[model samples]
Target: MTPADCPEKPVVDLRSDTLTRPSAGMRKAMAGAEVGDDVYGEDPTVKRLETVAAEMLGKPCALFLPTGTMANLVAFLAQTRPGDSIILSESAHPIHYENANLSMVAGLLPCVIHDALGKFTADQVEQRIVREDDPHLSWTTLVSVENTTNRGGGACWELHEMESIAALCRRHGMRLHCDGARIFNACAVTNIEARYYAKCCDTLCFCLSKGLGAPAGSLLAGDPETMHKALRFRKMLGGGMRQSGILAAAGLYALEHHLGDLAEDHRRARRFRQALEAEGFEFCLPSPTNILYIRVENSLRAVKTLKRRGVLTLAHGQDQIRAVFHRDIDDKAMEDAIECFKQALALPR
Candidate 1:
């Protein structure tokens, strides 16, 4: 159903940060954005956004794509050959959430490392590395990591750990890629700069639609040569766009205005976590950013009960519910959400 068809504005929408609609200021920017064909590299606004994104990530170049999944696919396609293998945390978005694009589209094999917190040490990477002498194994070519890991309750990878992993990849002649969909959230909470995290990877991409509140788009950044190669894969994957500056303008506005406000979302999420904890709710991990996963007796029933109370959340698993805070949810909405949870807990199974 269309947004206007809803009975009323939701008291709180913890389903995902992607639910955020463009703000008036962002809409104004989109309306005034200049137009050009991006496939031809002539879109002035898109170029500006790419440049800003690259500088922010301390990369030599950046390419804007329609989605974070596409950005990741192109990075893999550019970095690995068809028979090569890549290593990733088993809980990564590509493994569970991206429809197996790494295997289906990129034709790459995956070496999964199971980790509850969505992070694995350099030692784990070494264990997963295939021996080159064993011709039976697919050559491990790339290592990918996610920041503010989605399924891991928005856990951020420590910089030292990332540095160790990057060093290992370099030593093994492998490329490092970062699925930095929530890199800004990590930066906001840890007081680390985006560049430091970007520097730990051979290529990295961050979403404009998630915490940034843009209508659509993600930017992949890396060295110029690799990005040039990725550009072709982007088009091969049908990601080429014409006059995408309208969307890029929203990304630009988000970068300029919405970035500083991410801490507020984190604060709200923490407050929500505290309230749930007080109600005897259990979480898989600490809420470091805007995402939290609460353990419930029956996730589906809890979600239904919360919805009946004008609150919205997602059933993450049979017994887990995921809540994500964003620009759209305010302090009042958060309190209402907490109260709704309390009420849901009081209901009979």
Candidate 2:
């Protein structure tokens, strides 16, 4: 499905990894899945996916949600009571991308901190906390951190930094939540264990559909009590599925085969950036993960030009364009994208 504001035949669609269709392998796995009623909590294959994902992330429990948006929303609601506020970077997905689901469903206010580069510290979190004694201030009860933060140029946070901020949250009696949508990209880029990062937060959600190439699904991991509450929230959000093992099977396959391939995505992103740089295109910086942001002299014209050439991507603003590499996009697609970009830039004034 198309995931961007623009569209084309997609000779090389780099709009977002979410646009990837289920691979042949994923389709095979889905067709053979063992199914049962999941809302009743009896779908064995779905349960297995949750159990295995929880074990991989070192969390006691996991719940499979249809979308990462739902996973994030459920975590927010489960962790904070109504009128409580959740802290996150200004560029965080929940703040800018999730259509205010956190506020609508969770009744939680967002305390946005400006950190466009994805660099924030324990002190930053501490400083953002509001006092309950102030009637004008909302009670800040949760801190949300994003791994390989999307608008942060796909920069990964150091593990120690995550730990320090998480510890500060614990000390301040605030829960820590991680919107780890592309966290495997963080792990692949930093060579860190996913469990290590998982240990640093009280709850976290990761996508199976992005770098992993699963057709759909995200796992929300946390302690059992919190996860039980997440499950209830899932049902309330109409996210509880029946016989969802059919979809969970794809997530299981991705977990087994796709995790190791994320390094390749990062490599392709770097290669793409290098090619663009060679063609005199400007980029914000080197993307350490699968996503890259290109600074164009005229973003709308560039996007229109690329679309006409059968390539697809999104403009970040009037001067920036964003693209992502995934399993489906290979060396050839990158070559085509670079060529299209070169042609677009080389157009006569």
Candidate 3:
């Protein structure tokens, strides 16, 4: 059908899943949440959220932070000393999205491994490890991996590979951390429980703001000793909250009600990919989760065009436009998006 034949619809927002607004149920939970000063460790709702997150992830302890960035950075700060080094993929979030916090705040050296899919083998990490006898080199103290890597088009790392890396870190007297901001998405695709992934790392975090549909919050989990240190670093970084149980309440609601439907987002993503392919468009890579990267000659031009047609998206780089699916997008938005894509592709070069 042509533009005239399509029904009127709200804007199709495929820019990022973080754009998802809190659902009514989540808002209700937030409204009714028990509150106290979390910094003083008196918040009942925050405690419950942390307890539930720790149990589900199989970590002995958990801490609630305002954002995933804080959770990831606190983990790094807690596990390593200043001048220590970290190993992470070129596409890891801390490398790009965290505004150089690892260096400026944590004061650690970053040793990067390049992988287009945002995965590095245990062998790659072993090669990056510094020789302790070499007094001139900073010690490699930590290795971090992203699950459903953001800049890598939401790619998930294999559990076996993670186990290998964890073993290698243990042998080298280093810690393994998973930047699992979208880990639940990985779980949906791989049929793996969050606890198994937690078992492969000394620390990891997952965001409720992204696919979980919370307005704001992230949980960092690890062994009690590491998490004890992490709590101190979180306070140092100003992550202590006064009454964040209101936000934690949304997280609790999401975990209880939203997890089972994540696979549906994956299905919609696949359907969107197939639909776009039928229009002669191509994705930069096939993602198993909600994120998709469409290849275009000029990403900026395509983004502007799609925006004018009432479909919102992000430009991954110079040549790829990214679209992410979340609970906010529905069948109507998906159909409208396809129609807009058909029209956008018909534009004069």
Candidate 4:
């Protein structure tokens, strides 16, 4: 059944930060946004948003795309030729969640490195690089990493580790791309500026729709030359939008208002984790940010029970349930969620 077909609205939705609706202020901004065809680079508000995003990330330029998937795809298209290989963490969103666009759209082979926390070492990246002399192996042309890794229970990568990988990529003439869908959350927890993280990669994409709470948008930032190529790829991929300032306005509002509030979501997540632990639950990883993965005896049962109890969550695996916090859910909802979880865990195995 579809969500619209459901009789009840969830009292607390822990499914994902993507479920957040734009605030009233954001709606007003969107309505008042001045518009021109973004495809022609005439949309002033989109240009403003792009300029602000580029400045924040310390990139020469940025492109506003409809979704993070498109942002990542465009980056790949700009960076790699067909048959080139890219290395990513085994649980990375691009490899596991983006419908294999890397191979299908970019025609790039993937080499995955398995890690418990979704952070890979420079040594692992070096080991995965195929020798350029070997005609049988796809040359590793790019390395991608995810920050506040979705499947890693919102784990953030250490800055030094990322710098090491970036240095290795540079030394080997390989480009590094960051799938930073929840990058702000990482920055919030680590007290690191977004620019430092951006400086570690050749290109990076971050979602405005996730914890940023924009209605829809993602930005791909990089050196001007790469972004110029990405702009073409975005058009080729049907991401060209006319009068896109309406959406860009929401993104701008989100960046200005919601960026700082992300730490509150992290705080709520930690409280939720503590509550779950008190109810005899174990977690797959310590939630340093807004996403939490609870180890359950039967994830299906837990999900069903939580749904019936007016709380929404996702089954992460056969035995893990995933909960994500966002701006939409409040302190009262958090309390209700804790109560719901308590009752759900009390159910028979």
Candidate 5:
């Protein structure tokens, strides 16, 4: 069942960061946004948002799309042709959540990297490259890495590890695309600029709706040629929109104001995990940011019981319940959530 299946309406929804609503300031920005047709490249607010995103991410250009999933798919479509193989971690969002768009729509063969951590080393990627011109094998044309990997308990990639993978992709003459939906969270934790990571890859994308607290939108940044190709693919994929500056304005406001607050989200998540651990609760990994995966005997049962106690979460697997902290979960809510967890799990079975 979905998050909506909770028997009692949840007061503290920790299902995902995408649940964050726009603040009054962000809503004001969207309300007053100057708009024009974005498909014709005449939307002023969208242009400003793209320019800001490109400069911050150290890319030559950027494009705004409706969803993070489209931004990623456009990256793949722009870089590789049919029959090409792309390398990605087994725990990647595209592999699990994106409905096989990589294969069915991009017409690319995926070379899966079986890593439990949702990250792969440069050496592992180098070994997967198809170096031969044999007509039998699909040439490895692209490599993708996710920052603050979702399924791997929100583990952030080490800068050195990313650099090594980028170097390998450059040496192999392959395109490197970063599925950086939560890249800003990684930046907040590491105190590293987003541009540094962008420099190491051919293209990068970040979502406005996730931790950034925008209502909707994502941006993909790259050089002129790649972005031009991405623009075309975005249109082909029906991702083009008219008067999208309203949404773009919200994204711009998020980058300007909501970015710095990400640290607090991280702190709240760590605090939640720490309190739970003291109560004899188990976590799958150390949460460096806002995502936490709690290990339980039955994740589905835990989720249902937690919902009844005014807490909400997602079942990550049969034995893992996932909770994500965002702007909506304040100090009071966090305390209530902890109490709900202690009470739900301490129940007599």
Candidate 6:
């Protein structure tokens, strides 16, 4: 007995930008969706969505997954065996947010490097790969990169730099995996097609529920062999859902309409940054994508103040906060949030 994936759809939830409910057309499509049990690979709608994603990403195959974390874990499990090592930035979602699921599922070890700007060059990646002569070390078998790196304030990787890193990985007999959860935002901000970004990685996962405004789902794309492996791993993780077309419908709707809206999100983020600066709040770095990090004195108090004012954001640490702009957070919310910041700063220091 499986409960329908979209039992209830939210309309506007900007807390994480993943709360966006399906659009009206998406709901209608989901209600009348063509579905089958996905465990047997017989779900026509799921197959169609997978095919569409694969073709869009220039990959031979793709897997529809229940969540971005599962998509990333499945790819890692397929790429690395126990005791194999992989290099990734310290800010990678897999390292900080996935609760060590990488080690749990793939038996993979992490070699972390700091990437303050969210873009790691070829030299940085090559430096992390252990040399063949180093017998005392674990073999570095994979290089993982995150686009619009969450901790880097949604920064994007340049295409040329990524190509260079991919070539470096190939020379070392290492595969490259991209955790591109907000890749559509990257694509929208950079004005680049998604396939061009896919060219630099052996496998990649992108979320439909994030900036794309889908209710639930992410996609992992790769060559045929890897994708087949991922499909099997997906089921092993108990992610096989019946009638998943309800979720797939929203993904399709997002791909069609919401991709362009990410630029608007970026615009609003820039506006918010300007307002924050006007109130004497400085940024640690430039706001590139829809995510911006604010350098503040009392992070927790600021969060509480914003929450009280009907605004929501995350407190990263004692000195910094993260404010994410999404399609649902319009200009008015941005202004209200800025006022909240100013009011919070005026509190007893």
Those runs of model 6 whose alpha carbons end farther than 4 Å from true positions after fitting are: 1-14, 131-135, 346-349
Judged by lDDT relative to the true structure, which candidate is superior, 3 or 4? 4
Error of 4 at 144 (Å): 0.2
Over 1-349, each residue of candidate 3 has an lDDT whose tens digit, in order, gives 2456222653898988998899899899999999999999999999999999999999889999999999999999999999999999988999998999999999999999999889899999999999476878999999999998888888887789899999999998999999999999999988889999999999989999998899989999999889999999989988899999999999999999998878888988999889878778888876989999988889888887887778888877899999999988888888888888888866344
Error of 5 at 287 (Å): 2.1
lDDT of 3 at 315: 79
Q: Which candidate comes out best when scored by lDDT?
A: 5
How far residue 212's Cα lies from its native spot in candidate 3, in Å, is 0.7
Candidate 2 Cα outliers beyond 4 Å, as residue runs: 1-8, 347-349
Clashes of 1: 0
Model 4, runs deviating above 4 Å: 4-7, 347-349
Q: Which stretches of candidate 1 lie over 4 Å from their true place?
A: 1-8, 347-349
Clash number for candidate 3: 0
Q: How does candidate 1 score on lDDT?
A: 0.91
Off by over 4 Å in 3: 1-10, 347-349
Candidate 5 per-residue lDDT over residues 1-349, each given as its tens digit: 5546765567799999999999999999999999999999999999999999999998999999999999999999999999999999999999999999999999999998987668999999988999689999999999999988988777788788999999899888999999999999999988889999899889999999998899899999999999999999999999999999999999999999999999989999988989988888888877788889988999889898998888989988799999999999998899999999988888333
Q: What's each prediction's clash count?
A: 0, 0, 0, 0, 0, 0
What is the lDDT of every predicted structure here? 0.91, 0.87, 0.90, 0.91, 0.92, 0.82
lDDT of model 4, residue 148: 82
- How do all models score by TM-score? 0.97, 0.95, 0.96, 0.98, 0.97, 0.93
- lDDT for each residue of candidate 6 in 272-320, tens digit (9 for 90 to 100): 7887677677888775888888887788876656665556667887988
